[model samples]
Target: MDMINGYLEALPEEERTPDPLYRERLDVCETCSRLQNGLCAVCGCFVLYRAGKTSSECPCGLW
Candidate 1:
């Protein structure tokens, strides 16, 4: 979790997803069957880090 936080903190403001949208994306991810150990099984990305970026998208098209 610390690593994910560090990566998020390092992103430029414009590159980061807005707080509300980030949370919303996370909410979607949380309910996904593809979620495993805080990661997206399809893409093998840390959900925290992927959802925190404006450019990131769910591999399953849920968000």
Candidate 2:
């Protein structure tokens, strides 16, 4: 979790997703079957990390 937080903190403010959208993206991930141990099975990425970036997209195209 700390690693993911660090990655998020490293992103420029403009490149970070807005709080509301990030939360929304997380909410979507929460309901996805591809979510496993906080990671996205489709792309092998931490959902928290992936959702934090403004340019990131869900591998399953849910986001």
Candidate 3:
């Protein structure tokens, strides 16, 4: 899984946005990951692209 994680890690931070609707969209993706944004919204694992530490990171691949 390191390849997958690394691929995610190398993404640019600008790719992430703090839109409130993104959170709601995250919830929806939990059931089905159909979002074209290419983020793991259910687990918020995409936060790694933002290039900083967040509370959500510890439990996911962000570490």
Candidate 4:
């Protein structure tokens, strides 16, 4: 459910990051203590979708 919501909330395609960058961001999110399940414990955002958006960023300053 969170994954679907994340994708739905992602920035428009024109503003999204490349696949590689998105994955890199996901990797960073996966290792963070703030990530809970598929969401960010800090902001309660879906890491997958959030990471895919070039306009978005880690609230923790990891990215």
Candidate 5:
């Protein structure tokens, strides 16, 4: 249990607000299987941008 506590403490702070645009796009993708309004286009996953690993240009299409 002590190890579990240490692991939890080591994790980054939890985000209070889910990315609105990403959530919306996720919903759209689940239902539409495509980027909503072409926002998440070329993004295989919605969290790619938030994770800072996507190599494409700005994907802030929704906003």
Candidate 6:
């Protein structure tokens, strides 16, 4: 997806997850079919961005 067309709703700084946790989640998303580039087709959020959110969930339940 284009930068302007991607999910712009970012999690507040306080709600973002720690680097390690995000990295772990990203590992899973990377191998998932629902993941495209860094974006999640199910949630329309970048895998890095979405994985960084403590509250964000993987629609495919892989994360």
Model 3 TM-score relative to the real fold? 0.28
Give all TM-scores, in the order shown: 0.95, 0.93, 0.28, 0.78, 0.26, 0.69
Better model by lDDT: candidate 5 vs candidate 6: 6
What is the per-residue lDDT of model 3 for residues 1-63, given as tens digits with 9 covering 90 to 100?
A: 465457645655554434464454445444453333645554554533322322233233322
> Taking the tens digit of each residue's C-alpha lDDT, what string does model 5 give over 14-49?
522244644554454445434554335456544333
Per-residue alpha-carbon lDDT of model 6 for 1-63, expressed as tens digits?
355223323545677877788778978987888777677888787776667678888887776
Q: Ten-residue segment with the worst summed lDDT in candidate 3? A: 49-58
Residues 1-63 of candidate 1 have per-residue lDDT tens digits of: 898999999999999999999999999998899899997999999999999999988888899
Residue 57 of model 1, lDDT score: 88
- Structural RMSD, model 4: 2.7
Candidate 1 vs candidate 5: the TM-score winner is 1
Q: What is the lDDT of residue 8 in candidate 5?
A: 38
Against the unseen true structure, what C-alpha lDDT does each candidate score? 0.93, 0.93, 0.42, 0.80, 0.41, 0.72
45 Cα displacement, candidate 4 (Å): 0.4
lDDT value, residue 15 of candidate 2: 88
The lDDT of model 3 is 0.42
Alpha-carbon deviation at 13 in model 4, angstroms: 2.8
Candidate 4 per-residue C-alpha lDDT over 10-39 given as tens digits, one digit per residue, 9 for 90 to 100: 657777878888788988988888988889
- How far in Å is the alpha carbon of 16 misplaced in model 3? 2.9
Candidate no. 2 TM-score: 0.93
